[model samples]
Target: MDNLRRRHITSFQNGVLEPIVFDDKRKSMKSILLSSIKLQKTIAPVLSTIRNFYNKYYNTIHPLCFTFLSFLTRFYLISLSDVVMWDESHFGKFASHYLNREFYFDVHPPLGKMIVALAGWLAGYDGSFDFESATRYPEDLNYTFMRIFMASFGVLMVPLAYFTSIELGFSKHSTILVTLMVLFDTAYLCISRFILLDAMLLFFTLLTLFCMTKFHNQSYHPFSANWWKWLIMTGISIGCVSSVKWIGLFTTALVGLYTIEDLWNKLGDLSIPKIDYLKHWMARIICLIVLPILIYIGCFAIHFAILTHTGPGDEQMSSLFQAGLIGNDFAENPLEVAYGSRITLRNTGFGGGLLHSHVEEYPGGSGQQQVTCYHHEDFNNDWIVLKPREMEIYDNETDVEFVNDGDTIRLLHLATESNLHSHKIPAPLTRAHWEVSCYGNDTFGDEKDSWVIEVVDDVYKRTNHIRSLTTIMRLRHKVLGCYLRAANVGLPDWGFRQVEVTCDKRNNPKDTYTHWNIERHWNSKLPPGGKANYKSKFLREFWNLNVAMYYANNALVSDPDDNDILASKPRQWPILEVGLRLCSWTSDSIKFYLLGNPAVWWSGTASLMLFILTLFWYLVRRQRQYTDFSPGFLMDQFTASCSLKTKNMIFGIHYALIITIFWYFKDIAYGVSSPNIELKDKKWLSTWDIVD
Candidate 1:
């Protein structure tokens, strides 16, 4: 048996039995423990490697966290106590109406107000005009919620700006710089504090740019399904931009031009045969032209549906329809009416358009020479160097006397009148240049010398005396001269008016007297003797002058007008409201200028077309020169330096999709929570209303 066992052992050593014996019982257990220890050691390093990989790849902050931070920063930057800048008041009013489901006129589209209303609803603040609550109220909501929403938009802009900058061949540092500049700019901050459409418009504009960049860089076979989806997305983004502002139509034109350039660039070295060229071209055309139009029309359809069914209030709906009808009519006939009355009411016989009249020949005498004096030739050319001419004031105890070398003088005579007393010193003397000076001693020397004098009547039947006469006199000579004289005598209050002047040449009598009104003096060059019917037109054009002067004065006293406020107020039928609001903070002229129908769309379209044509020509020339083309070349050139690591790109795309989906569902949630009858009464709401 031992010999057999030894043989078995020897055989087993070559096979399995000897190994089993060597690892028997306690030895086997020790061996197994060693193996287990080795496995445990290996597991720790492997697990550690895996954990480091995960942390490196997926450690970005949640989007919600960033969103929250953005909101907080916005609220801090825009304090609640901040006064409503010009435009914010209009937006605030609209948002309030939106929250209450009350009607409000809107010249602009409803997207911006809708955003503000959404924020207010999320915060559980009722949009009422109640002034009782210090916090959690509509007024508070107006500033706070709008700030938070806009701040969030501003923050979201950072990544998009970075992406666009990178795509446009900028360095990472440049991207950061652009983002920081946008974030900290006073214009951006001021705009974010109010509910304005610009932030939203900018956001959509950037998004469209990104989509176009993506389409230009992506690698896709002709007619690939994935390529079609990207093209559709590009069209949708551009359409969304246009819906925000009519200026977005320019953006659509840009996309169409890009598509044409892309196709032309692919034409020279097309990998596919000529037979397939037409198909590829058709696909591109569909993406560039047909798809964009469809998307644009789709957005309008949504707008139409919303306005028809679920618009804020009855009055708002009526106004919206009326505005729409008016817009349609204007589109059909774009002619504008000229601003002028049938006949020139104030005809000096030398007339034309108001702007066409010469300054020297203005009905209100030439600005060059005064009635009694002329401008000095030694004055500086600089406007700031010109100062008001100086005049002297004199007091002679009993009477004031004004002396100047000029032929004209303005006499302000202060006299006291009493029912108990009336007295005069020297009057009833008619010389060549004699004119009535009421409440004054109308005395004249034998010579045609100008004089200003006043008589005073005592209050308690006392003797009358000359109180005071203040005169501003200008000497008619080669040089401009001014002098003032004053005398004081105790007197009560009285009123005076400038009387008509009749000049005698002998006393030189030249029919030089003209009609004087509150603001200006009207002069007509008629013969020395004729039926000179001088009627005062009282040109209330002072209103226009005051408006212009107001702007100039404000420029001198404060900063330039707030453009943020001007840009926000809508300008359709609701323009009256915007104008009223602007008048509160700006000159009437500026209000008119902003509200006036300037050619915003036409100018923008022209610029867009020029850019598109230039880009097209450049792209075509490049394609002709370099015929060896590959899809990879375009992709690599367009997106080679973008920091879209595979994992991050995938994650970003997923996150974006989720956010978009969330937006759609959030609208639904808002609808469900709304105080409408469909939700409250358990009635089935049509899909048209829901989608809207």
Candidate 2:
């Protein structure tokens, strides 16, 4: 038994103690074995070191898992119902139209809407209906699906921003901060919820900027395959952005400017023999100018093809030529076309359109009076305060009973009475014993003495032949005045006078009357029945008065005295609508030209010029001095000054510019405006008010 116990102990020490042997051992023997053994020792420090190393490197979850968790968290935390807004409706409608094979004059580019439609189709939602009908799924589900799409983009932007920041040499923290800020911004959040183009624009523009920075930093030749590829990508990206909105021109402009500056800086660095200046110049031209121009043209070609494909009709080609002509015309003459009819006078040597008519014919006519004719208070004479007057009477015609006193009366008569006292007119035109009389009868009263109302002018005026004609001419010059005065005669009214003035034509500037002239003959008659005979005279006289006034006012105002005084007519709504449509069409054309061939043309030419200039300078100057021509002087300074802080600042600027571009152009591309509410609002505590 002791030998057996010894054998068991030996077996345990050797790690060969089988379960059966242990089970078969007696209780006393087991206790003795348990107490007799020292506790098994461990390499605690080595284990601790190993554990520390693992925690440092492998304890954190895998990036893929983290990303998945992030997406899940976003899905759970964000409320899809909170995404309700105008842009979403517009996007849904546009996508539906696209999916239904319906043609539409979409102002925005089709990429973002296409993506949304694709998502909807994959999710078993109909993309060929209006938002309310197409989004028939539960509101939360529909919105969540849309939000998830946008959120995916948002998350993508995080990595893009990081890589771009690194390419720009931004510090790690600044890059992270910019990404975080964008991630949490309420505007960004809300915008992302809808399938809008802004976020996409931001992404593209950032990518472009990054690529451009990389291109600039490279020391390789411009004609290298890699360089060409980068340039092509840059061009395509910029073109896409511009396709979304006209404002993308700003980005294009910036890129062009930077390229030119870079070329200029490199021009002074060329090493060439003075005798072989021409060869070097040719090389520089090909590198800087020709290559860039080719790239720019290639970019523009894509845009041109797209635009031409989408434009309405074959008129686009002719319109383009006309556009060029119009631009030249505008540069030559800056005047805008007159708005309305152009009157041309016949049988006059001065005949022209009314816009160019002589000012003497219709002086001082206000533009406002041409469109709407009405009686306005004569502010020139405060004593002539006259209210609008109307006379009404009942007339029964066959079966129709007409009530003159009712609100439905159609005929209206306007009257004004002028008080003529010896004190009102000049004393030379007034006499002591002259009398004025008026006569009129009511048609409804059988023309009896009781139906007639007689009026006598209490004031009188004595007039010589000259003065009487002068008064007649003045009175006839006012059309409405003459009409009212003619109606007032032979009626029960007061204030009538015949006045005259005496003056020689050469000496009297105010005496416009000529009694013997045929034009003034109609002005000599008395009122009421005489109105018909004076109609032409009244029109002529009033027109002359208006012409005189218009000139005088024009002189005082320092404005043109052309006959187009009344040319400022209200724009017709249809015409305005047509004009807007035309403008949009033309704008699209301009954008296509700018994005496609123009970019290539300009960039290539600029590069060629830069290269040529560099070669020329290199050949002309000997032993380049730092102050005079060294390109490396400024380059070294620039590189040295680009510390971490400066790089961060630059990255910040890049981020800001990219974001701003997105904000401005997104609406144009998406056909929607920003919303007016927060993305998430939690109101847990509130005061309640009850009204009875």
Best by TM-score: 1
- Taken over the whole model, the C-alpha lDDT of each candidate is 0.37, 0.34
Estimated TM-score per prediction? 0.37, 0.35
lDDT of 2 by residue, 1-692 (tens): 55554323334445676533443457777877766553322456677887887667541332333345335433443332333344556766655654553433343444555666666666556654455522333542355566567656655554555556556665444445445444433334444445556656666667667667666555355546666666656666666555444345577777778766765555655664444445434543554345544543443333233332212211212111111221112112111111110111001001000001111111122111001011121221111111112333323322222111111111111121122111111112122211111112122111111111011110114222211111122111111111101110111111112121111112222332211110111111122222221112323322333343343334444235664321232332211111111001222121000011112223334545666676577667754642344433122223345877776675566446544543442222222222212101211112100000
lDDT of 2 at 139: 44
- Which regions of candidate 2 are displaced past 4 Å? 1-79, 82-84, 132-146, 220-222, 272-692
Q: Write the per-residue lDDT of candidate 1 for residues 507-610, one digit (tens) a residue.
A: 11111111010111111211111111111111222222223334333434433475443333233222222311222222111110122111222223454565
Q: Give the CA lDDT, 0 to 100, for residue 470 in model 2.
A: 17
**TM-score of decoy 1:** 0.37
lDDT of 2 at 620: 71
What's model 1's overall lDDT?
0.37
- Listing every candidate in turn, what is its Cα RMSD in Å to the true structure after a full C-alpha superposition? 23.8, 24.2
